[model samples]
Target: MIVARELPVHPQASFFGAGPYPARRAAIAAAAVLAGFVLTAIWSAPFVDSVIGDSVANGLLGYDAKATPIGGVLAGTLFAFVSGLAGSFTACNIAAFGAVAPLVGGQAGEKRRFATTLKPLGWIAAGMLTVSVVYGVIVALVGTRMPQFSTAQTTRLSPRSVQSMIAFGVVGLVFLLLGLIALGLLRGPGFLRRHPAAPLVLMGALIGGFLIGRPYPLFRIMFRSAAEQHNVLYGAAAFALQSVGNIVVMAVLFLILTHATGGRVQRWLAAKPARIATVTGAALLVGGTFTLLYWDVRVLGRLGIIWFPMISW
Candidate 1:
């Protein structure tokens, strides 16, 4: 018989010491997912021409190989981050439930109720991730289509369009007001203790309202000019700028919602909101900066602002 000697555990290796390991693991997983997304976006460029050849030839959309190579890349990166974060949050919640389920079930009915509430959140996150990925793939495959632009596009503002914009603006203001009200409700004494989920529910409602009310008619107006100019770089830059704007507006609204709901939202909301904000902000800032740098160079080219070396990277 062979004798086996067990290794002694380190004295410092307590449960508290091990607590941050899961967080570190989650961060690493998120980073890896982000990297994979970027790589996949780069790989999808070759198929763009073949996938949308008919649309391009039919004058429905425009495509330039050299100028817009980065469009798919940017879209892919955004979609990947969104989907990855959603997945990470869902996984973290599921893990939390697994650990707490036994204790909660043994004691008061808190565990069951908590798990029941969490299930829908997880499902919604999953669904959103799926939709984001599908949209990303479609965008990548078809490339972005240029909207038809005419003189009507430039100068014509219809009465119905004006009325619609006014209506949307009014609706958005109402939601904004409601969000503020919810915030006030949250700040009352014992509000956090009594109604933990109220802030999240209110925030979601506000964000949904904003998305529904916002108009992106600019894309339609600029489509023809962008395509006729064969300015893939300009198109990509504009798309990136628009996406950044959307993300910025969403982030500001998110922050406002959280602030209104009290200083801190729920654990689940708190965890991913910071990460999403950080990633989205970083991407937008970097993309916008680069786009502006290039735009300045082009303007200099056109206006004779400065004569310098035409450095192509």
Candidate 2:
């Protein structure tokens, strides 16, 4: 007698599942981002800056931090680290939180708590440092200063304003497009959808790019110091530390969530594809809208081209 046996079949996972879930996610994400844009417009357009940008930097490093001469390599490293820690709260930098959900995985029956928790953070660091190191090297080799430091102004735009416009505008569009893809409204990169770590890497790359057009006083100071050192390695290290500092708080929060919940949060999210889409899509939408409206549209108001509410922090 011959017997035939059938092998087990497994279902493929969707980046963002099909069905009513996509529509629900899109609606929820759009509404949330819209509300955020409204609040930032009426309140703080460059929300992080208005909220804690220069003040945080100045308070932590002192007003003279920019002008003070570096005493040693260690001092400069410390400055870069502290400055990054200070900038963590900025609207621009805060967008890095979008990566948190993507980084955490809900592996079925996973028992290694320490590895599970720290692995995501390490992946994030790898992605972040990859971009930061490259950017630092390129910037160092080319030898340029932060445009934000320039006082020269055109009829309506300054160097700083233009930098903000270009940097945030590009990054915002990318985030917006990513959110759309995550919501299933658009196609995502094949790799990004298939690989677990791809989204985290992309998110980290965006965070590293923050150095391209940042205007924070302490950051500007750090950049100048890095330039003066004229060592590409130093620049790379400083920028690396900066990225590290930017996410320290968020990392702590993620750890707390994982430990406090005993890893239930990610497991719950992983059980359903739509749940991940909801969290990630919402974050990307908010980050994208805030970046665009704050840096570009808000600049128009500063130039007196339109009326945007002005507030004193």
Candidate 3:
């Protein structure tokens, strides 16, 4: 009689036991994102406004620019915490999808297929999240202190204000250019044909530059007319709400993109030989353009070269 021998378990089979069910993981990530949103709203509504008001008043009345810096630091810390929570939520979602892709796509016949996809997604999410949190914190710290740097009277457009606008406009142009370059690079032959990474990188750069530079002019214009506007508090709250809302919107968009791409992502990943050079080069170029725009605007404003147009409601 011939003895029957058990076959060795496949590596792909291990995935079924390695992580939590995909649905559960996705739900947990969603919950974390929601919780973070709630916490951010609470802190931003009253606490942040009060801090800003105090900081502004102290700086203006005592000519103590340091008060603004203190306020900025506090705001930055809060934003950093919120950004961290958002990053965690995003990461968990990416992991869940990665863990489930093989099962969902029915690719379990291939060894280590799921792990292969998940690893890169996990690393990319972690790196992007770290960068976002750091960026958010820096923005918050500097933003709160901005009002203190102005001249005593609000209505008159100071020479410094003009300088700021010119600087900001130049920076915006630079980011726009970089975004265009990224688009061109992505259209070139290579992994760009399959990966969405290039587009994402371009979007991030444009968004970052707009966030940092665009706001300065608008804020300056608003500051001048704030006395006539009774809704300064509301404006502050709206800004905070918008910031958190944008994150939620992006997460939803990512979900949609994932669903839309479906099995194509897996196929592309399996076929490509990890084109790191292409992805990294495109990302760095786009990111650097945004950074340049951000700093240039502030330097220009300080030099009194441009003035932001006031918005009338």
Best by TM-score: 2
TM-score of 3: 0.30
lDDT digits (tens) for residues 83-181 of candidate 2? 898788775676777655544433322444666568667767887899888877765666565465577888778897788789878888888777667
lDDT winner between 1 and 3, please give it.
Answer: 3
| C-alpha TM-scores of all predictions | 0.24, 0.82, 0.30
State in Å the error of residue 266, model 1.
15
By lDDT: ranked, best first: 2, 3, 1
Report RMSD (Å) for each prediction in the order shown.
18.0, 4.9, 16.3
| Model 1 per-residue lDDT tens digits across residues 1-313 | 9997533221111111211123343343345334423432232212332333223322322343223333443443333233222221111011111112111111111112434434433332333334333333333334434112212332244333333334334433332232222222112234523543432333223222222112223222233223433444544443333333323323334334333444343323224423322222222222222222222333244345566333331
Model 1 residue 252 lDDT score: 36
Stretches > 4 Å off in candidate 3: 1-239, 294-313
| Top model number, lDDT | 2
lDDT of 2: 0.68
Candidate 3 or 1, higher TM-score: 3
Prediction 3 global C-alpha lDDT: 0.33
lDDT per residue (tens digit) for residues 77-182 in model 3: 3432233223222211111122122222222223334345444334334433443444444433455444324565434454444444454455434333332232
Question: Model 2, residue 182: displacement in angstroms?
Answer: 1.8
